[model samples]
Target: MENIQHRNINVNGINMHVAEIGEGPVVLFVHGFPELWYTWRHQMLFIASKGYRAIAPDLRGFGDTEAPPSPTSYTAFHIVGDLVCLLDSLGLDKVYLVGHDWGAIISWYLCLFRPDRIKALVNLSVVYNPRNPSVKPVDYMRHVYGDDFYICRFQEIGWEEEFAKVDTKKLLASFYFKRIPNPPLLSKDFAKMFNPPPYTIPSWYTQEDLDYCASKYRSTGFKGPFNYYRCFDLNWELCAAWTGSKIMVPVKFVVGDIDATYNFPTIKEYINRGGFKESVPYLEEVVVMEGVGHFINQEKPIEINNHIYDFITKF
Candidate 1:
């Protein structure tokens, strides 16, 4: 851990925080909601050991990075721009990219908008959703999944007050383990949902891990993370220019069979049938770890490290 270096670099008009290690072909990691670069610690160390430079950034609006006060600033363009700038600042021409959750979504956009900057991509948990020109993203989710869908709950932007009512560990617990309902209604008081008299965190996540994350969130707050959700509609609007675009970079996708994103009925057919390949023509493989969940990289770090090493090493 001590060998991993942490620093802030100016990118896309914000000071972005990055954690990096090793000295070989670069592997950039992007994280998702309610998470920081810390989420990639195990993968970073493992990938670094495998002769790759592993870099994970606390994407703008998360961790030590500067959070713009507006949701609009959290759009795909803004985040992607920050990343491209970060790469440029590091003198990296191209990198093997890996992302989870929101990071996966943003990486898809990065590939679409700037394929010239990526050598290959390994996206986990979330699959690419090619823009649907007819309807906005939030509207589409609302129609298909309903207004109470988790994304819809974040639309108006007051989740933080209710989020504050619970302990940071519990908030992390609810997010990391609690299963969302079939229609994905994120209860207003959802933070308390993880409670049971004798609570337990997965054995893989240690108390030190929880304490570290708790301390970071205590300083940064979750609004920065929530803002990513708030920009769904705006991203749809801004991304119209690339409505029919496809991700051309070499790709490998891994998901937990039980992950909510993979369980979406449309998604299963899309991934296995043809929609995913149609959207990402260069996608090379898809791996579903039998019993794993959304946080696959963290839950099964050794396996994920092997996955990243095996795939990226081929290029």
Candidate 2:
């Protein structure tokens, strides 16, 4: 965490907290769900040492960034708008992009909505899905996966009440793993499921890392973080204007073979059958890391940094 500079820059009507280092062409990192700008700590140092300015922001919520009360405010347009405005505020025109999890989703939108602002992108843990004019994304998930699906559960009101029962550290820690079940669902026995016996933190992710994130979440609560899910249908609706659009930015995608998103029944087939590259026409490569999980960046920092550098350097 040393040598990193933190500051708040007003963007998109919010004061966005950014963690930055080095001093060259910018590498703007976007963090994922339940994560902060601090999520990219390792990559910041590594990429900065490699001579590029490394910048990571907490997105619109989930860290020091101000969270709007309405979930409707967390749409793809809103999040992407904040990031774009951040670039403007910082006097940047275009920068290399890196994203993971929700950040990956937002990065996809960033490329789709404003490819002119990105030199190249390296996205982790999510594949680019072609815009389906017929299916509302969340509705499709509910139809196939049922209400027990975590996204469905998140859609229901008061899911955060359940989150409130548990400590934030334990909640985030349960998710750190090498592999997670495909189609992750919430069982009826909620307490037993989330509040099970304590376990040790994985060596790849330290107690300090967990503590840092937990401290942030403890202040903001999980409601704003879950707001990203709350806007799934809205993002789909708003993006109707962009139906059938392909991401124009050059991209390199990486995922863990065991990542839950990777294991989604049709995801692998789609990624392998040329559908992913079809949507992302400029996709430079796809790297499937063995035995990794949803938290790909933090769990495999060196390899992730190597992957990011390998592709971005080409630009």
Candidate 3:
């Protein structure tokens, strides 16, 4: 990790922090919520060793990147714009893309809005959710998961304060290690959810890792990250033109069987019953890793690296 290089560059009207290593074909790694570019440390080094330049940025509102104040600024357009401009600033015309969680979500939009810029993609944890022309995203989520669903709860202000009241390290540990396959619910007493007794740090994650994440969140607060959830409806609205659009880039997707996202109602049916392929017309492979959770890359680094290397090397 010490050999990896970090720097900041101006992109999309904000100074963005980026981590890079090696010098060859570019593989851009986008991380999900509550995660930083550091999340890609293992894969970065592995891919770099294999002759691919690995680039991971702390997306807007996370890590060392500039956090714009408005919730509207966190939409897919804004996030994708940041990336597109980042690539432009770096003098790359096209690159292999890899993302997990919200990063996966943004990678979908990148392919949708600017397929010309992507050579291929490997998205983790989340799949392509086609836009519903008639309903907003948050509305559909509320209808399916109700008000206590984490995304819905994040829409309201003050979650940052609530999260702050709890021990930051423990809170992050609970979020990173919990193995619940069901979608998370954030009730009125959401803070209590992090109070579970005696959490054993998973072998894949260390106390130092937990401390590093907590330190960043404690300094930046959670509002910027929560703002990503706040833009669900807005993204739905702004993306109306691309409704039912199929992602045309060659793609590979991987997920953990135990991940809550994989267990979302009807998601398995969608992925396995041709719905996922229909939306991602060029999807080449799907890998489901047993016993892994949402953090597939971190939990199964070598396997995930092999999956990425195998696919990206094809083009």
Candidate 4:
């Protein structure tokens, strides 16, 4: 960790924080929900040691980056725009792109909106979900998964307040250690999920790590992060021009076999069959590690790092 260098740079009309190390061909790492650039700590160090410049930035609403108050500011275009300006600020034109969960979603948009800026991509967890065109994302999620589904429940106006009420460290622990292999259901009585006694930290996560994330949330609150979900529909509406677009960039995807996202109803079929390939025309590889859960990179750091290095080296 001491080898990593941290800095804040101006990008897309806000101050952005980034962690970087080593020096060679650049590899940009983007993190997911409930995570900051710190989540990629292991991979950054490992990849940097392997002679590649590894850069991880806290997306607009996460970590030390300035979080715009309006949910409308968290759109795909806004997030991708921040990254484009970030690369330009750093004097980089194209780099290897890697992202996980929401980061993966945004990477898909980045490749779609600016493939010229990406040499190759290694995306984890979430697959590229093609727009339906007929229904907005939130409405589609509600119709398919019902109101209790976590994403649907997150759409409510004051949900972040409810999240704030819980103890920050404990709330983060619950999210990090969760192992349910099905779609998450968060009822109106969602507080109960955090109320279970005797919570244990997973082997992959430390108390210090939880505290680090908690301290950031304590200062910023969860509103900025939650706004990412809130902008789903608006993102859908704003991306109409990209309706039938294919990701075109060279790509590799990885997911944990037991990860809740991989188990989503038809996700397996979508990934294994022609659908994923149809959209990601340049996909190069797919790996499903057994016994792993949602936080694949942190849960299985060495293997994840190797996967990333192997793919990026080819380019």
Return the TM-score for each candidate structure.
Answer: 0.96, 0.97, 0.98, 0.98
Give a tens-digit lDDT track for model 1, residues 184-289. Answer: 5776667667363444778768888878888888887878888888888888888889988999999999999878888876988998799999999999999999
Off by over 4 Å in 4: none
Residue 221 C-alpha lDDT in model 4: 83
For model 1, name the residue pairs that clash.
none
What candidate 2 gets wrong by more than 4 Å, as runs, is none
Cα lDDT, all candidates: 0.87, 0.87, 0.92, 0.92
Better of 1 and 3 by lDDT: 3
Residue-level lDDT tens digits of model 3 in 1-315: 888999999999999999999999999999998799988988999999999999999999998999998888899989999999999999999999999999999999999999999999999999999998988888888999999999989999888788888887877777788788989887788776556677888888788888888898888889889999999998888888898789999999999999999999999999999999999999999999999999899999999999999999999
RMSD of 2: 1.3
Ten-residue region with minimum lDDT total, candidate 3? 190-199
lDDT value for candidate 2? 0.87
Report the alpha-carbon TM-score of model 3 versus the true structure.
0.98
**TM-score for candidate 2:** 0.97
**What is the lDDT for 26 in model 1?**
98
Ranking by TM-score: 3, 4, 2, 1
